[model samples]
Target: MEILPRPFDAQPLDGTSTVPKHVQLRESLRSYIVRSGEPGAAIPSERLLGEYFGVARMTVRQAVDCLVAEEVLERVVGLGTFVARAKVDLHMKMTSYTEEMIRRGMVPDARVLSFEQQGASPLVARELQIEIGQPVVRFRRQLLADGEPMSVDENFIPAHRVVGILDDPPPTSLYSVLSEKYGLVMEWGEDTIEATAASPSIARLLNVEMNAPLLKIQRHAYVARAMIDYSVSYYRADRYKLWVPLQRPGVRSPRAYSSKRLG
Candidate 1:
């Protein structure tokens, strides 16, 4: 494996330049990281960086802090900072995780953490449009991409909708099983996404530290008017990002706007 360049080998920041010292250092470090092209590669300590750059340790920290906030580098407790993996951009769409991962040319897999037939909680019942305390099939799964843990998902379905799911082995793709065996195809879904800290159990399953940043998503998948699946998923913020496209309404081209104004 190619090695990371030493801090002294990096170009010294120009004091006469108009750019801030921290910003200059940040760009220099970013260039080195990109050139290395190695995820999880550990750069030099702040002390070494400060000494080599003839700056204070505080200055070195400022540059590192900026990269950390941008997810370009990650600090591990007692382990130092390492280059972060690029985040997966998930387009806001109506598709299963399996389908999305496959389309991205990554191997997708799921491990059933727990499966049970239990009474639906008020939240689950409301989301599924079923009676409170009704029996529901609950499945907790760990979703993986390229053999790495990506998210933890808890799903609930009304027991009457798919009677024999408990008897059959837990499925890697719940949507596939629902569509093929029960004829319940998910036509649409409503998603609520938010930023949250990882709980202890969630942290363990996703292999992240407790209180780490995570993306929490609650979804209601429906087959026409009937709600089929109610699920809550927690994804690692470092590894996943939601992508959305926006268009401004009633916008006209520059030439059209000019012509309209003249007319």
Candidate 2:
């Protein structure tokens, strides 16, 4: 059986418009992909698109190049371009990776890469709020979702807080162990997120190309006034995206304002 290419269902390009043809084609392609609602699906070839839109193949290529650069489409050597996988949206919240993965219906796994006690460096000391030379438990793990590599996490905790952590088996969820065994329930947390390129070591652990874009998150988790956990995590930007909610402050409803005026 032969598989025919899906039809593109966007409005025809306006040849007389002042807007650039590539830009118009790019938007039309974007809209068509959204309406199709399929990930990893192959898009029409440049020749076919050029013929349908009455444009040069080079124009079609330029529009496709823009989408490829934005990661909206990916090209394989022997295969044609495809719609990229939808990135997982990470809502800003105080939740463990395991819990978040479960909420997203993915099986979560963690492979412990390194675990040992180490003297706190200046930066580690400042982040964990411990003495410069104080002992700390340092552990690095490669986090996964459905057996696929997702992120690499390196954690630091005051040795005095988790005294026997090094002796025990590495836990899948550190927060769970802390609350169950040590009575250190996390009350609040602060995360600093930034865009960064993956280093060689991190790229190896996360199974991504070196210098690929990553979301670097530095977290400080607290129990009451004491910081209990500090971790630096690098997430693959191709697989994950940050989602933040926004709201305007001090807005009043028109009905409420009218009632207040009458009162």
- TM-score of each candidate? 0.78, 0.73
Model 2, position 254: C-alpha lDDT score: 76
Query: Model 1 residue 185 lDDT?
Result: 84
lDDT of 2: 0.88
lDDT of 2 at 155: 88
The most accurate candidate by TM-score is 1
The TM-score between candidate 2 and the true structure equals 0.73
Per-model lDDT? 0.88, 0.88
lDDT accuracy of residue 259 in candidate 2: 100
Regions more than 4 Å wrong, model 1 = 1-25, 53-66, 76-79, 249-263
Quote the positional error of residue 218 for candidate 2 in Å.
0.7
- lDDT tens digits by residue: candidate 1, 1-263: 33336533567899999998999999988887887637978888898788778789999999999999999998988999999987899676767789989999999999888998999989888888888999999999999999999999999999999998899898877888898999998899999999999999999999989999999999888889888889999999989889986656787667778998999
